[model samples]
Target: MSDPKSLGLLAQFETPADIMHAAMAVRDAGFSKWDVFTPFPIHGMDDAMALPSSKVGFFTFVGGVTGFFSGMGMIWFMNKFDYPLVVGGKPLFTPLFAFPVSYELTILLSAFGTLFGLALLNRLPKLNNPLFSSERFKRATNDKFFVYVETADPKFSAVETRALLATLGASAVEEIHDTEA
Candidate 1:
């Protein structure tokens, strides 16, 4: 089969420990476009996967700063410049009055940033994956743990990747083919 039509390989492990060891092996082998799926979250899997820190926090921080400043600016513009109103002997533009609005805006924009950042980072709206074509992969969300290595990875070799996973104690190793829609 052509390389483009081959999605990659799927290695199924009978247990979490087996998958964990397999994950470490794959990582050390320098395969980048790979992922592990478990019935539930696995502690230290991030370390095994060698995933870097998330960029979502940076987005949140920038959004919060922008929100706070924009809130302060908007209030100042409206109260001090747009329609100046001096009530109860208070200064026309006191930051104290804008503090509540700014605080709320900071939280609001931070939430928006987090949502968008997660979607962006994860390549969200991904309607389909070639892995979904595997009948055994359905077990991934139930009893089985799986590691999928994409053919698109720089280090991917059909023969070598399959052999590596098989040696890593994978109960079953299967090559996945893309399903054209």
Candidate 2:
């Protein structure tokens, strides 16, 4: 009977400069529940938005742990478990041989962990979102940036939000809806 709750507003910008200004304006206005989308990352934008760096280091740590164990296991399997070999009179627990593959696996696993972890943490792979409905939002993949504030935020109100965006010099602002949430 009533328009579904709004996801937020989508303000599209034609250039990084406009987006940069928008970010600063949003930050200065003290709006924490917002994000910027750009064709490519722009330097200083993160600082402008005051976004903290992600805790991907924790993911890397998990990956490194996996890699270390896997590497050690492979060596143990080949040297001790399955095939015991005496090469050049070297001991079976030779760290030298294991180091290369082990190191490689460490880097590999850490990288995979970072990728998977980020995706999981961000809840990505979101192929469709209400932002897709805004005609101007298509430029995000080419040369546009956007900032959205969810209605769930305490500061959100159609009239007040529009007023804030206008004060922030948002080029164009339009409401976006996400019925399914």
Candidate 3:
């Protein structure tokens, strides 16, 4: 059997301000693998955590560009090459005529990109997590805020990290163990 592994420590705070302070402190302490959970979005948390802007917008842009070109190519191939047709001296293909379909497709593919990109980036479809085993963590959806420092971090030390969290005004700190380990 595998030896028990530490998932790191979970620190609970009573207010948003406390959690924000803890997050900033954790970030300043050079800990990389850490995260904070709150009942709702907290302003300035992203800056405190020093997280970079999301790349999902880039994915959406690429998808939209692909859709636009694909739509134009399909319209051109169908009308100008596959089965040419002339109606009232109109051109076989024109941007004016294809704009509607191309616009619709661009929007469609961009929406798909946003959805799938978010899912992939966030690692969604996860039905379970070790944190769910903690009854106190359940309050994350209601009132409490939590900051978790993962043992995977290079600078993580159970004793020092927990002490740092306590000094940052965490109401309670608990160690999270890896069930698979």
Candidate 4:
């Protein structure tokens, strides 16, 4: 039988401070495939992890622009070209008349953009994770903090990374293996 594959190493921390420090160290060490888990959000964890700004805003902007133009174009085609009509001595097509519909469409599409953008960016619907295999990791949602370093990272050295986590005050450093075929 084939041996289980090494997924990564899971390091447990006793407090928010310990995990925060470990995150910074892991970030500074240049390990890319790593993550931190805590019972609740940490105030400065983003800065500590050195994460980049989210692209979800960009997606929302694009969706809004597309919706607005599409809405306006549809009204223009229906009023000005398809069946032009002069009412109350006013022009067949006018921005003032289309403004409300366009605005509504813009808001609708922007919401959809934000939802889909977040899902795509986060790699959602991830039904499973190697970390879930660790019984101790369950406490992450209750009262524990954890730093997980994936073996896929180029900077991940089994011995060195384990020692680094230990030095960073990790109470327990356990290896995570992928048992699935």
Give per-residue CA lDDT, model 3, range 1-181, as digits (tens): 1266778899999999999989999999999999999999999999999999888998799889988988898999999989999989999999889889999999999989888899999899787888987889999999999999999999998789999999999999988877666
User: Judged by TM-score relative to the true structure, which candidate is superior, 2 or 4?
Assistant: 2
Q: Following a full C-alpha superposition, what root-mean-square deviation does model 1 have from the true structure? A: 2.0
- Residue 30 in candidate 4 has what lDDT? 93
In model 1, state the lDDT of residue 172.
95
Error of 1 at 60 (Å): 0.6
Clashing pairs in 1: none
90-173 in candidate 4: lDDT tens per residue? 888889999999999999999898988999999997979878889999999999999999999999999999999999999999
Tell me, by TM-score, which candidate is best: 3
TM-score of each: 0.90, 0.88, 0.91, 0.88
Clashing pairs for model 3 are none
Name the better of 1 and 3 by TM-score: 3
Report residue 69 deviation for candidate 1 (angstroms): 0.8
How many steric clashes between backbone atoms does each model show? 0, 0, 0, 0
User: Relative to the unseen true structure, what is the C-alpha lDDT of residue 101 in candidate 3, on a scale of 0 to 100?
Assistant: 93
Better of 3 and 4 by TM-score: 3
